[model samples]
Target: MNMTLTENTLVKDIVNELPKSSDVFKRNRIDFCCGGNIPLTEAAALADISLESLINELNEVVEKSDSGEIDWKFWMEKDSEAIIDHVISQYHNPLREELANLSPYVTKVSRVHGGHRPELLKVYELFYEFKKEMLDHAEKEEAIVFPLIKMLDANTVENREEALNAIKELEKEHDHAGSLLKELRIITSDFIPPAEACGTYRLVYKRLEMLEGETFNHVHLENNILFPRFN
Candidate 1:
């Protein structure tokens, strides 16, 4: 009833209750997995949302949410299927499409301006590797991991051992991919575009920055939320 309760509450506590699904969590930029441990006000500021509004929205969701997000930590203990599905649909598909459109632009710009900016070439090179790796990685999650995680939610322990073994391999790959993403960030210099950057260059930087942030959230969800549950 009291939207105020969600207003100043620590992000970590909220995340432990609301998860990535909570509208309040979404508005305030309270990353439900890795950076979930920040103060509510701080997270709101970082996300450019109103703290009070975020609280109000969350309260509305909670009041209406059939499965009231009373305990985020408890919800996380349930299963990883939902989070995986969200990633595949919301993040993966959109990202793949955006990457396809952006890659050619990056290549063209890099060829022309690379002699002067140089970072364009760096970004172009790293993006190629990142995009290629993610293309396969997303398929693996959809084809294999997603289904297996769903099985964990539905089936009993009869075949859990086999599932766990497969999940372990996926986890290792997740770590490796995480490392590569970190490297890509370094290569892009945090995706900073020069003031004099052309329109296309500016757009690339913006999208790359968004990609980095979204990817960070995605991996954190898998590593902290999904992987632990299944593995």
Candidate 2:
């Protein structure tokens, strides 16, 4: 059952799984490109697409090639040190670098053209907020939660209760961060840049979209694969 997943498995999750699946996760007319968090039941009702059909499609893709790739799924089944190292080395730092360049561009573009397209100002604010949230979020994961996950994975029950407590706190933080992200998405209208926007404006919006996609994948790895396996 989907209980193999965490509580936050929204419709957007299906989108993330599709790319890795090789076929079943298509983006055409599917709304996967936009709001990936809607429940599958909700999405099916909205689009008149059948849940059974979606399941069968996924099954076909899975059977065709349990493709021997070291995908996120592979890492999800790992210890805390493994997941933490992968996130910091592979995901977080590169995102920070991208945001560093993008933040100034947002301010610059808004300064030059805010009078014409006020939406840029809002976009600028949301991007900065997201960056700040992400910075703190990464630190929390590395400092506290990850160590516990690693400890538990290694079957070190000496500090098991303490690690469990840390995980509970981290889960609350995750909920807050997710709420903020959802608000940002609403503010940006699914990150569709205005038609009259310049390249940087468009690029920034595109980057946000990409980050959302990546973050969903990241969260899925933790929530569905790593956390459950460790638990």
C-alpha lDDT values of all predictions: 0.68, 0.62
Q: Could you tell me every candidate's TM-score relative to the true structure?
A: 0.61, 0.62
Which pairs of residues collide in candidate 2? 11-36, 11-37, 11-38, 12-36, 12-37, 18-25
Model 2 scores a C-alpha lDDT of 0.62
**Deviation from truth (RMSD, Å), model 1:** 11.8
Per-residue lDDT of candidate 1, residues 1-231 (tens digit)? 233454557765653343323334533445643565677678779888887877667676556423432343653765566677678886789668767766866797799789998877777877888888888888888997778778887775468888888778777776776676677668667766677766456556666665776677677677777777654
lDDT of 2 by residue, 106-147 (tens): 687778777887776776777787789788877888887787
- Give the 10-residue window scoring lowest on summed lDDT in candidate 2: 19-28
Candidate 2 TM-score, true structure as reference:
0.62
Give the count of colliding residue pairs in each prediction: 3, 6
